[model samples]
Target chain A: MTDYTPYVAAVYGLALLVYGGYTLRWHASYKKLERQLASQSQESP
Target chain B: MNILKKIQPLVGLASLIVLAVGLWYVYQAPADFQQGGAVRILYIHVPSAKMALASYIFLTVASVLYLWKRHEGADILAEAAASVGAAFTVVTLASGSIWGKPMWGTWWAWDARLTSMLVLLILYKGLMVLRHSLDDPVKGARATAILAIVGAVDLPIIHYSVVWWRTLHQPPSLAAGANADIHISGPLLPPLLILSAAFILMGLYMVTVKARQIEASRHLDALEAARLHHDD
Candidate 1:
């Protein structure tokens, strides 16, 4: 059988990129929304 | 009030810990006797593929709920799941292609499973695009829900494609039907299960956070519209 270490590595790395990317994106959106909520409350009050 | 939003931070933390442990388990497992190092990809690939299908199922159920009740909450969930599902499907397709190139001697083929999965991805994109195009939120949500339910027929087709058709992709190993080329055996099973749980936790956290974000944005939009109207 051919050595597939590199392919294996690449797949694992890609998994990190995809999952990590989404997690970061979700956190950013949550932070932005929280800030918006805070500002909106202040403006209304 | 979904309880998930309240514990999003905890969910995120648990996912990280689980992912780390899963990776550790994977490294500790013995290499496949048949596929050698390539079998390591199963730790990531199988979980992703499972999540891709699961997220869509969640989306379909959410869509059905929305259709039945005409609630914004259900629509938000459907929308979030579709977007997350789309991302997972992309991972599934990409990782599968990568795994296939070495194992199958080709990057891709017009296999039934692959083709149906591509269609699911396209439907997800359609859901996202439709979300933005329609100006009225309720109308957009209703229309999208209809589309989701209709498109859901593809789910079973994608799942059973290998059994129903001659496909290069392997059949389900976790359940009975066709034989898989590589079995999740001995030390390998723990890491596979651990990674699956980690992915599921992450998937749940994302959809919950995303649904909350979508609702918050919609509320913000309404407030802005009210302010503009007041100014007028």
Candidate 2:
């Protein structure tokens, strides 16, 4: 059988890149916002 | 919400672990008699497609709730799900195209199933743009919610496209009764199901994180507005 490993790898790799990239992006943004909120609350109170 | 925050990390970790297991199962499964190693693409393709559909459904429901109840959280949830759903749709289309190049001898076809899926991606993008395009947040939310509700008609069309017309796409392997034209064996089904579960967990984790971010940003906006009011 002809090797279709490259095609399979492309599919999996694309999925990882998209899902992993989004997760990291969201995590960083959320953490940054959370810190800002915490500091804002502390300053006000 | 606090409970969700506490469990979010656990859910993310579980999804990673489950995905690892699913990949292992896919590695163990033998190549197909006909398609050979190319068949392995189905593991990711099927699950991504399913998750894409599932996310859209979630978005539609959340959109409905937002429209009916006028809850900001539901609007946030709908927006979050739409973003996640868009990501899944991109993956689904990209992976399907990659899989198709070798199997179908072409990158894409203007078939019903494929066209509807593309429309889904377009709707997702449209929702995001509509929400941000307006200066008035309330107006934006209501307009996007209505658009989402209307776009949901595409879901059934996407689902039934295979059976309703002749197309390059095969009937759903997981479909039961007379609709099941493609029959995946018992051994092959497990990896697909496991990966699907993992995708669902991951998608849920992403949605929750996103919703929290949206909430926090809105809170900050309101606080800043109040501070300006105080100064004035």
All models: lDDT? Answer: 0.80, 0.82
Counting clashing residue pairs in each candidate, in order, gives 0, 0
Docking quality of model 2: it rates as medium
The numbered model that scores best in lDDT is 2
Model 1 residue runs over 4 Å out of place are B157-182
lDDT of 2 by residue, B20-81 (tens): 99999999988777677877887887788888889988998998999899888889999899
Superposition TM-score, candidate 1 onto the true structure: 0.89
Query: Where is the poorest 10-residue window by lDDT in model 1 chain B?
Result: B172-181
Off by over 4 Å in 2: B157-181
Give fnat, all candidates: 0.60, 0.72
**Real contacts retained, model 2:** 0.72
User: How much is the lDDT of residue B8 in candidate 1?
Assistant: 79
**TM-score per candidate for chain A alone:** 0.83, 0.85
Question: How do the residues B1-232 of candidate 1 rate in per-residue lDDT, one tens digit apiece?
Answer: 3676678779988998998999899889888777777778777878888898899889989999888988778888898898788888888888877877787667885555566678778889999999789999888898888888877886676657654665444444322211243477887799999999999998988888788788778878888899999899
